[model samples]
Target chain A: MDFLGDYTLRIVALGAGTLGIVAGALGAFAVLRRQSLLGDAISHAALPGVVLAFVLTGTKAPLGLLLGAAFAGWAATLAVMAIARMSRIKYDAALGIVLSVFFGIGLLLLTDVQKQPDATQAGLDRFLFGQAAGLLRSDVITMMALGLPVLVALALLWKEFKLLAFDPGFGASLGLPMRALDVVLTGLLVVAIVVGLQTVGVVLMSAMVVAPAAAARQWTDRLGTMVVLSAGFGALAGVVGAVISSRVERMPAGPTIVLCVTVLVLVSLFLAPRRGLLWARVRARRARARLRVQAVLEALLDLDARHGDGHAHSEAVLEVAGAGRGGAGRTLAELERRGWAERRGDDAWLLTPAGRAEAEERYGGRR
Target chain B: MTGVQLEIQAIAAVTAAACALPGAFLVLRRLSLLSDAIGHSILLGIVLAFLVVQELTSPFLVVGAALVGLLTVVAVELVRGTGLVREDAAIGLVFPALFSLGVVLVARYTDSVHLDTDAVLLGELAFTPFDRLVAGGWDLGPRALWVMSVILAVNLVALLLFYKELKLTTFDPALALALGLAPGLVHYGLMTLVSVTAVGAFTAVGAILVVALMIVPPATAYLLTDRLGVLLGASVGIGVASAIGGYWLAHALDASIAGSMAATAGALFALAFLFAPGRGLVAAARRRARQRWEFPQTMLAIHLLNHEGLPEAAVENRIDHLDAHLGWEPAFAREVVERAQRRGLVRSDGAALELTDRGRAGARSSLARTA
Candidate 1:
């Protein structure tokens, strides 16, 4: 409670939560565009930019680092595009190469900085994996200032982004400036990644951008609903991770936030009602049950067709279908409830006209 | 040369050789990013091995990392089967969770362990050579070299033995399955090899550079050629060249050796992207320009012939008419006129144009093909 009462913790938590919301909203498009890995790439590529900015401005100001990171991130995106378009290398391969190379250069620069004997280098190192506990009020304000316009732009261009995502060819035919829209979207993603870097770091920032959106996707297919839900999930994960990190000792808030987002992703993977693994299993079970009932009805119809009076022996029919006696009996009760079958005394059951028609239609009338 | 420098160079050579083999297959399968996932997720294996053996430098690390890498593949496949997420997203989801778990374990057990995150990410290539494989104090700084050599040999043997099978499965899994080949088994086998190669290389080059080595070399090779055999050969060549070139560059610049190596590989990929024949940017532009010029020339010729009365049998003189319609210089007009004459499209004694039997047939066929 005392840790939570600290001003630094409160400020950092608020900033992380707000950044998480923006990241989650922007990440919906990133994931949909299959550019989730771009977040990882761009965040890493920003390292060189940060180092260069430090060298250029002779200060470790957040704004300077942000500009440098944004430039490098966009440069990485351009390199990826060039590799993909001009060469046989696929987008993933291009992304991997660019990310490693840029980050490697950044590391070389960091080592150079380390040799300089300056205490300010400590703050720059914090940007590597982020230290949320060190964030100031001005940082939080800056995050909101940048995040608000991004959210507004996304709102105004929601229809265009949706159309471009669903079908770029159609959008182009409709005179939508798809190229410009793509640039705007990529710019938004780069900004989100750069801002979130203060809280999530370069290595784990991608998880913040991808995990919440991926989790939210499991619960909904609608784009607007997904974006909103993902934003909510991201905010919750951010607040929970911040609180937990504050309560605990020696746990970095960035990885903690990523861990929380990851937990939500796992939960959604297994437990979402509409499209999760558990739901899929339940749906499969229901389908199998329906198939069994249809199979029984089909067997009964087969027996009726073979007999002149349209009647069949129930026990013999059940023996041939290989369903358990209890299952057959349960299915018989269900069919009767649905007005699909009728009891003939205690030894036999017969299909009603509707049952016979449905059975014939389903099984090709052979039975 | 200093002993350390020589040893590091030798290890880099071995690592580059090891990554090149399975990397060729990964690129072909479009699973290049899986190498990145495997590279990151192998930390789990290393941690698990340390937990079991309580030692950082044990053979069990390789086995454990291999197991975890294979597990990453299986988990990704499981997620993909759900149809809820696409293949890329499934991969993006599963590996990060595994990697994050590994990071958390490291952070939680930092005091009890000597594993540094910096070492994990960047690798200690300089120190690898000092950890020698000496039996009875014989001073052998070649354990990594031997390990990589054996792995590379096994990989090559497996690829040679199953070349046809791998090709069939990679190009068309359905046909391979129908022909009674088990694609799943091949997939798992390839993944295991990738894991082994990744682990072997990680010791020498570190995770990030290993990832760069695995993807960039093969991707550059893909740009240069389309044949699988040539692609494999070119990838290995590129890997070796980058390893050597980057080692020297690092020495010259006094930079992080592994970082320089990865940057070199990236530079090679960029070079190939811009300059490789057929698919290169300059070549494509040239082809487009040539096509543009030839298309209009062909259109002008067709229009000239059509203007001479749809020219089934014969055509009248039309030089002045062509010049008026096409707006060509006399030299350009003469070139077109001479080309048509060479093709037997006209018989002009400085006066009239006529269609020969072959020319008439060619004109009709060309028009039909165009239509």
Candidate 2:
């Protein structure tokens, strides 16, 4: 059976895709600003908000819970900023403090709510790890309603937010209210986190904010391109993970989606152009090879100036030309492969006309 | 209290102290989130070890977890060294992927392995007493208590032996490097202790509260003291206190012990953040309040001294026109005038205000400081 043919599968895939796009876009700013961990802190902090909203409102209406999650996450963000700024404690420590304490508070609340005799909170803990199959049509609707405004706001504040991410001090010096803009940007991040909490769950939602942006960063230097690419990667992972998990028996979509996105991050880290690890290794290897070829060519050219063209230089001369560091045989073979140098009588060598020309182009004028 | 209750508290307190010991250094080094990372990544080790050893309580699990914890640090450094990702993002990238893999493994083999999700995330601090360590036929109290005590003792010994080295390296790495002290060696050593401590505390504080215990108490202590010795001692004391307080909080509410403990630690940090002398929120705000008046008075004095004999002196000195001349509000000008008069910095000559000798000296000193 086709996976998208199923109603629940379609709903969850759509919901997760929407969440990915929203988180991926907003998360780019967080990643660029060096606050990738702030997303982690806020996602954990939103747990108590989710539980408290359920306890106080007696309704699991998405809006009320979302508002509660947003408020708590926003407050946690403020607390982390305050602690980092007011005290000697650094930002990581501050994030640690706020995140765990708030998460602890959330856990306590969750346990308390579950113990109630009349409580209908059986599905509440599911928000912790997220069961994407539990995502209803209404939940998908709520995600869209929330994500639309968030992406719109992101588009509207694109320039200011970009400045806030890259050079907030310069913006502040220009009287741009950098602090307020920071609050707004972080607030959007909190919203981004809360919306995804139902789909990805609170625990893994932090990865959603980081993996996409980090992967996208390896591909582009432009902020606009990075943001768009990040969103695209996130959505791709979400839809694919959702669809695949729907087919697999007993495989939870949330972790599966996280696994998918993580694969993307790993792929990007090793394979993306320019900044990719594989590319860096390849470029370094090529550069080293080019240098080796150039050195051997220049040595041949040096010999040409001394002994005239096409002279069969002994392997001993090649060793001297190689200097104390030897690899003359391999260099000669590579030269032969490139038709640049020819071996004479097993050990001696001669530079071809083209090889001499190439060497001259590289070293003759500079030498 | 019953022996069971006492043993549980002992495990909690000892675990807290053990975490706080290396935790203070982590907080000082700005690697507090590494605790969070280490705590989660160690789960992978524990899970893999469990799969092989077929026992969750095996010491091999601790060894495996510690190795994974170290691997996490190595992995983070590798990613960050690439210059493709920032340090925090590197952290954010590495831990969850490890944790997600662990979750996947646990979920995949749930039939054969009873890796309780709640027990993994929240721990079973309350059940620590039930898991008694037995030697030959002798019951030697709770296993967690024994694990934490040995780890705590190891942490204390390590701290005492290397206190100076740790202090110098943490406070001034460049100076330490120039003096031939290997900061990198000290860093890995501290991280090893953190990883081992995290594994020991994993059962009592759970994984997340391991981070809370390691960070909150030390951060709270940092607010109260700048001395390294005092910081270390206070961090331990605060951690133990939070453990006890949190144990009681969970007892009262019948909630998660580790979470309650973390909340208690946070509450203590909150108290210090709001009220710690010289550095608390209240103290800093009060200091700024005083500066508000102090700054304006110095500016007024400077303004008066600059114009005392100039053509504008009469207009600038006139009490009625002071607001217009200085761009101050009329009410504020009057208030400044009254305050200056009361302090004997100025005197009224008809409608014009004159700066006295003390005011002139104050203005001159202010000018000297600025120059």
Residues B194-269 of candidate 1 have per-residue lDDT tens digits of: 9999888887777766777888788889889988899888988898888888888878877777877888888888
Per-residue lDDT for A1-367 in model 1, tens only?
A: 5755777777977988997899999989988988878888898889889888888888877877788888999998888887777666778787878888888778767766666766357767766868788887877887787788888999999999998788989999999899999999898888888888877777778887888999999999899999999989888988888988888877768878888988998899899987889988899989988877877887787777778497746755675666434468888888889998888888578889998887888885552
Q: Candidate 1: what lDDT?
A: 0.81
Pick out the ten consecutive residues of candidate 2 chain B with the lowest summed lDDT: B109-118
What is the Å distance of residue A47 in model 1 from its true position?
Answer: 2.2
Candidate 2 lDDT, B1-371, residue by residue in tens: 88887888889999999999999999999999999999988888888898899887789999999999999999999999989999999999999889888877777765534776557677878888998899999998899888999999999999989888899999999999999889999999999999999999888778888999999999999999989899989999999999999989989999888889999999999999999999998999999987877777777888888889999898877878766767889788877777877887888888887889999999899999999
CAPRI-style grade of the A/B interface in model 2: medium
Chain B TM-score of predicted candidate 1 relative to the true chain B? 0.86
What tens-digit string does per-residue lDDT give for candidate 2 at A1-367?
5644587788989988998999999889899989999999999999899999999999888888988999999999999988888787789999999999999999889878878888877567767877788888988888888888999999999988888988888888888998899898888899998999998787789999999999999999999999999999889989998988888876778878888999999999999999899999999989877877887777878887887655788667767876214477777789999999998897888889889888888788997
User: How good is the docking of model 2, as DockQ?
Assistant: 0.72
Which candidate number has the best lDDT? 2
- In model 1, the clashing pairs are none
Q: What stretches of model 1 exceed 4 Å from their correct place? A: A1-5, A294-316, A321-367, B296-321, B327-371
lDDT of 2 at B143: 90
